[model samples]
Target chain A: MSEILKMAWRNIWRNRRRTLITASSVLFAVFFAIVMRSMQLGTYSNMTANVVGAYTGYAQVQAQGYWDDKTLDNSLDWTPQAEQAVLAHPRVVGLVPRFDSFALAASDSSSKGVGVVGVLPATEDSMSRLSDKLLEGRLPAPTAAEVLVAERLAVFLKIGLGDTLALIGMGYQGISAVGEYPVVGIVRLPSPQLNASLVYTSLENAQELFAAEGRLTSVVLTLDDPDFAEPTCAELAASLPEGLVALPWQELMPELVQQIESDQASGFLILGILYVIVGFGIFGTLLMMLAERRREMGVMMAVGMGRRALATMVGAEMVLLGTLGTLAGMAAAFPMVLYLHHNPILLEGEMAQAMLNLGVEPIVPFALEPGFFVWQGLLVAALVAVASLHPLLSILKLNVINALRA
Target chain B: MNVIEIENLSKEYQTPAAKVRAVDGVSLRFERGEFAAIVGPSGSGKTTLLNLLGGLDQATAGSIRIAGTDLASLRPGQLIDFRKDNIGFVFQSYNLIPVLTALENVEFVMQLQGRPKAERRARAVELLEAVGLGERLDSRPGQLSGGQQQRVAVARALASKPQFVLADEPTANLDSRSALTLLEIMERLNREEGATFIFSTHDPRVVAKARRVIWLEDGKVVSDKTQEPTI
Candidate 1:
């Protein structure tokens, strides 16, 4: 066995140029595959951070029909038991309980429809970092009769800080939800749509105005690890009161998930095409190896070396080359991935604008995880192993007499 | 003292026109410790007989018994093992494994036989030394002279301690000096170690060194005679 391995190893280096060329294909495969996949995943990561960071958090608990119908009747009471139930999980980092409803915002001479969100002052401030986004004035006090309007919504209503804004809409059921409060703050949001339509105020003031006191439309949870969001959401949903469904950001914003999934599918397709090309490259090299060593193979077999042994030696050579090449590729791609991870490539021009318009951060980053690299390496190695079937077929039917003659 | 016995051995090859009988109903026997040569023309069955004796190609009709073990009864895989343990082959091209050092090439068959490392190494060194390649043990075949490479092949053939060695035009690719040196080493092994040698050749030098010469013509041994070596 050692003899065979020594022979197989030395045999690969006999034609250094050919071996290097063959291995270069594998190297290129691993490099491009890992980098491409990293880019795709990293872009999704950035987009997830961008979108989720803006408002959705990682998971949300809302009334059963509230997602389909954003009316106040479907809202849940902000009971202490409900808040404690969600915060019980060790993974929970922050929470924002909110009551959101849409109403007409009328100033003295201007009127526009806007999304009104009532939030617990401190928790919303920490989860959404709402105060840091304030363009003017402080966050509205939780119990104060003041509202935080989005810049665009304030612009449309022709109202500024200290100006009164009226909100009129149907509350819980059949009750007229109406109020007029002074705009204490103007906040600039990341999403243009939200900036144009959102109105944030204290939970007390919102419940008072809506005639639905102590009720919350949603409780957004920020987790320590976002990857655990779905499972946590499941556990939370199972334990929560009826008429409440815990939804991860994926379910809450399925369009984003669909977009990332489509990108991932295409990314894998591109990788599949790369593997085929590399497979052919490997096949070509092995064909040349068999062609060049036809007589040697014949002589070995003619001397009573079994078909199995010869084929194993040939296969071992491919594996050695592939292992070396992919490992080298992993080594080579590591720094590039690490660099891209730290200094992400920023999107420019229309691409940046488009990404921004879609509420995603405009950058292409690389995910530099060891698992991704190891998985890609194993995949290439497996492809090389499978490609060795070519040699097995050729050797099984090898005519020692004919080969010797050749 | 017969190490190999054959009865009506035959081999046929299919052609586009008709079937060609490569070895046709030839009967012969090789004695232990005998240095014999099968001499023939280009189209004669000398190589085919050697292939049959070595269990390389299946016989079309008849049986070959090597040391009382019937070649016909052994399966293909079993034949390979039997050949590995009993028959050593030296090809015309001095077919040393180019990737391995001469010593490793010699050790390859012994390794296949699952010999211990110390025994394989000692036997390989002893064989190479006996073949006048003691100083070039570590050299690769590519780095050796044609004569030296053939000597390594000889050592590799005998590494498994086969009962007999089969050579198919073993001296065909060597110059007169290298060929003579190789023949001398093989003759010495036959004389001193009592190793049986049977090779096919058209070369007169090889025919002259053999203690017995079998003249094969058109797949039949027309003349089989024993003669004293001229040298």
Candidate 2:
């Protein structure tokens, strides 16, 4: 067996140029696969981090079934002890206590239905980067009777900074939730849905207006990694009160999961097509060697070499090729992919806006995990092994006399 | 004692034109330490007969017994092993494995016969030196001259210490001088090692060196003559 392996090794180098060509085919395959897969996964990473990171904060702790029928009446009983206990988990970085409900806002010129979010300004700033998204005017002071209106909503009501707007909504139970609040700032929201109908105010101000103090619609927690959200959320929920539930970003935003799944399906389809081409390329080289070396095969067989041994030698040759190519490709591609992972290519102008609209960073970040190299290497090795079967069968069925004459 | 015994051996091939009987019914026997030659025309079955005797091809009819073992009694894998242990082949093209050094080419059959590495290595070196390729043990086939490669093939053929060596027009591609040198080495090995040798050749130089000659015309032996070999 070792003799066969040694022969196989020497056999490939007997035709150095041809062997190099065959190995190069696998090399390019693995290299391109790594690059393509990395970019695709990187874009998904950016998308997940952007959409879930900035706003939803990976996971959310809300009243049970609140996501289905969101209203001020179905709010979590907020207590400092409960909040602190939930935030004590190692994975949890911070929490933003929020009061979210719908309210009708009216100015002298117009009236519109808006999503009114009541938040601790500093807590909201840490979680969703609300302050960074301010288009004009200062963030409203905590406990101040001030409002931050979405730019589009402010435009619809023709309300500018310092303009007083009347807000009316049904508060907890059947109470009339109405107040006249001054719009202190205009802010921009990334999503069109949010930009058109969002309003922000201090938690203290919202509780007084709704006649419900020390209460929260939900508590959105930010974690070290969005991917950890589900497991963390699971443990957090089990440890929390009976009426509350924790929702991971995947559950909180199923559309994003669907989008990622669809994209991955398409990516794999493309990679499958590439592997077919590479497999055939390796097989073609084998065919050429077989065609040219029919007599050599016969000679070996005639000199007491068995069909199985010859076939194994050929198979070993291919394995050697795949091994060489995989190593070379990975060695060549790793640093480049790693560089791109760190210093990503940032898209701009309409492309940047388009990416932003999809809730992902404009920069393309590659997923440079070790699995990328390992799986790609395995795939190419599998292709080489499968491709070797063609020649193996041919050799096994070889007619010694015919092969000799040929 | 007879090392090889054959009775009515035949091989038929179905070409597009018609069935061609390449080796017809013939009976022959060969003994140990004998250097024999089968001389025939292009269409005759000299090469085919050699292939059959070496277990490389199947005979259409009849049977061959070599060193008391029936050819038909062995399975495919066993036949391969039997061939490795009993029959050595030297082809017309000096078909040394281009990838292996001359020593490796010689050692290969012994290795297949499961000889110990050190034993095979020592035997391979001795045989290579006997064939006059002692200084070229590390040279691959591509680096050797035609005669040197053929010498390596001869060394390889004897490496297994087989019951007999079969040479199919082994001197066909060599120049007269290389052919004479190759035949001298083969003849010396046959005499000193008591190794039986059988050759299929049209080369008169080879035919002249054989101690016995069989003439075949159109796949049937017309004459079998024993003569004293002239050194």
Encode model 2's per-residue lDDT on A137-205: one tens digit a residue: 877798898999988898899999889999999888779999998888998877767888988999988
Docking class of 1: medium
Write one digit per residue (lDDT tens) for candidate 1, span A140-229.
897888899998888888889899999998888769989989989999887889989999889988988888888889889888999898
Clash pairs for candidate 2: none
Tens-place lDDT digits, model 1, residues B23-80: 9999999889989999999989988899889887889999999999999999878988
Task: List each candidate's DockQ score.
Answer: 0.71, 0.76
Interface RMSD of 2: 1.0
Question: Which segments of model 1 are wrong by more than 4 Å?
Answer: none
Point to the candidate with the largest TM-score.
Answer: 1
Q: lDDT for each of the candidates?
A: 0.88, 0.88
- Model 1 error, position B209 (Å): 0.6
